[model samples]
Target chain A: MKLGDPRKAYRIAQGAKVRLNEDDAADMSLCPEGGKNSTQGLFDSLRDRIQTLQKVLYAENKRRVLVIIQAMDTGGKDGCVKHVFSRVDPQGVNVKAFKKPTEDELAHDFLWRVHPHVPGNGEIVIFNRSHYEDIIAVRVKKLLPESVWKKRYQHVLDFERMLAEEGTTIVKLFLHISKDEQKRRLEKRLENPAKHWKFHVDDLADRKRWHDFTGAYEDLIERTSTDYAPWFVIPADRKWYRNLCVAKLFADTLEDLELNFPERDFDPSSIRIDD
Target chain B: MKLGDPRKAYRIAQGAKVRLNEDDAADMSLCPEGGKNSTQGLFDSLRDRIQTLQKVLYAENKRRVLVIIQAMDTGGKDGCVKHVFSRVDPQGVNVKAFKKPTEDELAHDFLWRVHPHVPGNGEIVIFNRSHYEDIIAVRVKKLLPESVWKKRYQHVLDFERMLAEEGTTIVKLFLHISKDEQKRRLEKRLENPAKHWKFHVDDLADRKRWHDFTGAYEDLIERTSTDYAPWFVIPADRKWYRNLCVAKLFADTLEDLELNFPERDFDPSSIRIDD
Candidate 1:
């Protein structure tokens, strides 16, 4: 039950997926409808801890954190980034959302564009979607030969190793949503007029290739979960649980870094006595 | 007294310089240290309102906001951004801090580097220091020809006019602190063993040129205060008042935008009965 030592813990979490049950699901649903009163106590308590750790971890320990999130559509990547990071000290955090590569990015190697945006010392950087996209997109569309796509796994591990050597701690999360849950969510979007804006034919296209995408993800989790940068497969069927796990992981990492607040010095006796 | 209007009120506030009396200063000092209690009430009432308004403003009214901040070294620009924006919905807001130009940025016109970061429709962008740096740095170090730097005022005015025509609302703040206060803060930093790393020799060089910098700031504020993007001179000697004024301006602006949450199609009765 203890998620100890990043690499070993990651493997156990991944393998323990088959053992996940209703209790975990119930715990995730701790967040209630209003999203205000129901979860306020948990988030508020954690928020204070996060603030204190952030100040110390950033200004003193100066550890750099890299968060990698890969998920199926409507799996709540945006929501996770926003809500979990709601209490972060922004000065030491940078969130980068990578979409389709621009022409300039195309000019360089895949890792080149990503290198510059990596968190500096005592900083936290979140990649909404990252280099893993290269594997997913290429695998789904057959954009590359099998040999070519397979080679990228080693390249990624090596890239992450470089980052670890440079003092970057990486947390990669794969939001695992069931096919049936996805279908229900998609139908809800289609049934509503206002929500129709979010639905697209391409979503259905991706769903049709669900098996291939799952295989790609399975391979991804197996191949790239290294000692330096490990992956967590979080069940994202319920959003409340997703937020809790993500928040816990972030706080735990800062605790691992042993954050301390910067000390202040002032002469208390310098003030004049009252007449 | 009304600092809310975009035109006439700006002119009036610009004409009058108000100083806080000792009693007023004493009363305002009671505002929370570190911005925790100072703006608590304001945040509680306006948090939900701002959230609902953000989406509507993004979809319907679509106004762009450009916030320009001017301050001395360690005047809390970073702290203000971190605390004041801690509650905002990020989909509509962006923060840009200007540092020394990179090689590519130096090759182009200085404004060229800044023009790209300006707010687009439905965006609220914060500029930590802005194109006015050309004037400030140039005036102090004589980095550019007087003719070139002087001409930038007219250029900046024209650029802002273009943004206003395109629906960008501008807010500029100059965080003003006395030399005595700066000396006290800097001396405290030097005396603090924990803060030794934060103190840089370069900062002392800038502090020695305090008179020159103040003169430059006076001229820049006098000339650049206009109907559009008028500057609010805030007392930086007290951090709480600065946060209060900034929060007030933000709340008032969103209210003016009249943002409302979109209606969801989910059946209210279905949930009510089940619950």
Candidate 2:
């Protein structure tokens, strides 16, 4: 399957598959034809192209693009944004990383805090662990009742549909890594002094419920993927391949829009300098 | 007087000053030597130096810095922040621009919305048109009754003293521009096509009541300029000079604290990689 169209290949076909990454990690490879070294160079070139396209995108100022990245712990979401989107002009792009909600955020509906940070026309925004967490985390941990959590799937669909109809292109990616890979990353974090701040004891408790999390992920993917805004499950054990695939998808989606510089209606030749 | 101590240079002595810039602009100059070209270079170097101090401040994690800049329309408050603080690490600095209150914010006390954004330790926060607006704008425009606005002066003094005692360094600047200079700026906005969006018809009405604004500004600066957070009147007719002056004040204040790099407990030789 073409790597650009990950939906057909990675979309959860079974509503009742009831597992996250149940297939072997070896089976989900989506790297284009190249050695690891060559693909790394290609990723750099794609990032440069994305930066150039972003200037035109800002000038055109017609549509907004929102990229939602959801991943398990130690799943390289920060690494993907830093490596891929850092080259773009900061004025044109905004990155909102949703941590724990605050008192005001809890006072309103789940979408209250997320709504204020949505991208405007001619803007590119990335949500690191976005509204999906409102559903996935609470569901798996049993933080909310089954009746409350189950109804959120339709709310998610309607929100995306409204945004899509109002000229937003939403690309949601679920970073899929093997359970063994997460264990290795967690151990590495504990061993490395520099990464110790990132390690939490509660994370070990969350790790214990790996199966429940997998079931929640499979259910969300089956229910929420739509034509207006589809979900793609990207193999994320290898950082280089994950960044390369996200950047490729971003570039392709923006290029399809055919953005152009805004029209300037003045005669520059007639203006004199040094007045 | 030393340029580093703008308090002596511009602080109002009595409950009133004859004018915002009563002396010659040449006398009010804070830029050191080499004319305008070199002052611009000095601003850049100070910005770089401020960036260095911010790193230590973040590591120290003991004190917070709050910068409050209040000015009339087209009074160079935005320009000062862009030129002075933009180079600081985005993680350490936040700029909050408060406009007309939202319905929810209005439902609460005036200080409710403003109190939440105060910086924590190891952070710098800038308020562009802050709570001081509660007194100046409302009093001049008669948005609130005389009895209600009169009590705000003491309230501001107490609020600022509490913050100062709790370990926040407050720097307040009133960007003082002449009414004539403001007229020229407003006219320039009309003549320049790119700046038309910033020009508003209501601004002309504000210009009509420049005297009332001046009276309100004089009163607030007198009532609220305690030793804890004294206000400086910056001569902002020249953008370059204004930026240089503000950056200088910031550098001198932070330097007086004598921040130190945090001690490293783990020896470099003890921690080995690639196990």
Candidate 3:
């Protein structure tokens, strides 16, 4: 099964206006004729390829990869990562899930905590939810005035631009799931005894303001997506397809680096082992 | 196969004298009678158990675990972590490797950079090298005066004591290997083309000053090991045995927590989802 180019299919073009409501949450247009069943083999291969590429990246030790994933509740952000990068070495890949800021974190500049977590040389760092929360959640919940949250779009762009210029490759993904699909997922969580710990009452409050959240995402993606750091709107309503697309997107991004293991400086043939 | 109690065998007694040269790097006293070959199944089970307990810890969202690993070059710090915690969820476990202090890091207090990376609630953090370096490396290399490095021991104790009082569990491990074993590992790295990237000429300088490093370690461990945050010295010449001991130590620590999935405050049966 041939996977379509995720860069072309999903990436939000720079300066393009985005409409979340108009986008298909269950789009499988990029999937091959065999659809989800046949794509499992491709997905597995992509994960293996990603693992191999990550090793080369780690060995190269000159560049970094930053993956930012944003999603509404039950949009499969966690599931997508679990399926896609499951094969990568945990030592090289770090997942940072940004929760509500503590008093100490809130006292600092918005990017202060985030700057410390950026990928060092030869590392892949994934931001599960990121500084965008300061813009999106704050805007929708009125935690900050429009004038305050409005400046963050430029601040984020500047921050990402600096990261990119400093040899960091950036990929931002928005797990796009429909409101109806979220309701189905929420209901499933409520029905399962084991999953109740994951179901929070506050999630219901976010669900009630779906349009506001979507609008916030649309604005953030439109304003933030750039040539340096592109935003990909992943159709996440279908679990299998979402995983496949994410795997392919990540593999494609890493391959573009043309990574290679570092050449040995000393002659290995001349070295002797006394053991 | 009965694995001996690691806590009883390896943990340094508070206020006790320590001698690095007296410890056996290849000691298998903790290993079961059946030895390395028999411990594979046990190792696999411990990894699984750690994974399960970590989930409960994440769900409980009350306590934190901090694992500190210290070792000489090629003493199997990375290898031990890879084998022991391979099954842990990457989302919950964070490994921070401290390399040479950067200009910015040197400008701040020793613990300032480390303060931000401590485990958050429901998280497990592993420090590949830690604030101990500020003492061990500084004293051994003569980077700081005796008076300056000596005071840091008290600072670290105060820092860790506060973390313990605030519901963070601390476990520190030092991987002990002999000079002959270090020579073998360094030679192996030079002999293998694939491992040449892991080798450095500076490692030889450290090896030449092995006595200095070990002496610093002895003094630091003797002074710093306390009831709140104790240190364990693992025999590490045998890779399999080192992994087994570390795995058992971690699993035993988590079991002491008696972790359970948190109960939902909202009644699951009463909660309804409109689909």
Docking class of 2: incorrect
Worst 10 residues of 2 chain B by lDDT: B266-275
Error of 2 at A56 (Å): 12
Point out the higher-scoring one by lDDT: 1 or 2: 2
The Cα error of candidate 1 at residue B228, in Å, is: 4.8
What interface RMSD does every candidate have? 8.5, 7.9, 2.5
Q: What is the interface root-mean-square deviation of candidate 3?
A: 2.5
Model 1 over residues B169-207: C-alpha lDDT tens digits? 887877777666666766766766655546555676787
Best by lDDT: 3
Per-candidate RMSD, Å? 6.5, 7.1, 2.8
Clashing residue pairs in candidate 3 (N, C-alpha, C atoms within 3 angstroms): none
Off by over 4 Å in 1: A1-42, A102-109, A143-148, A187-197, A259-275, B1-39, B56-64, B90-92, B100-108, B112-123, B143-145, B158-168, B180-205, B226-228, B255-275
- State in Å the error of residue B105, model 2: 5.3
lDDT of each: 0.68, 0.76, 0.89
Candidate 1's TM-score reads: 0.77
* Model 2, runs deviating above 4 Å: A1-69, A73-97, A101-109, A112-128, A139-148, A160-275, B1-19, B22-28, B39-65, B87-93, B101-108, B119-124, B164-168, B251-275
Clashing pairs in 2: none
Scored by lDDT, model 2 comes in at 0.76
Model 3 DockQ vs. reference: 0.38
lDDT of 3 by residue, A206-233 (tens): 9989999999999999999999999999
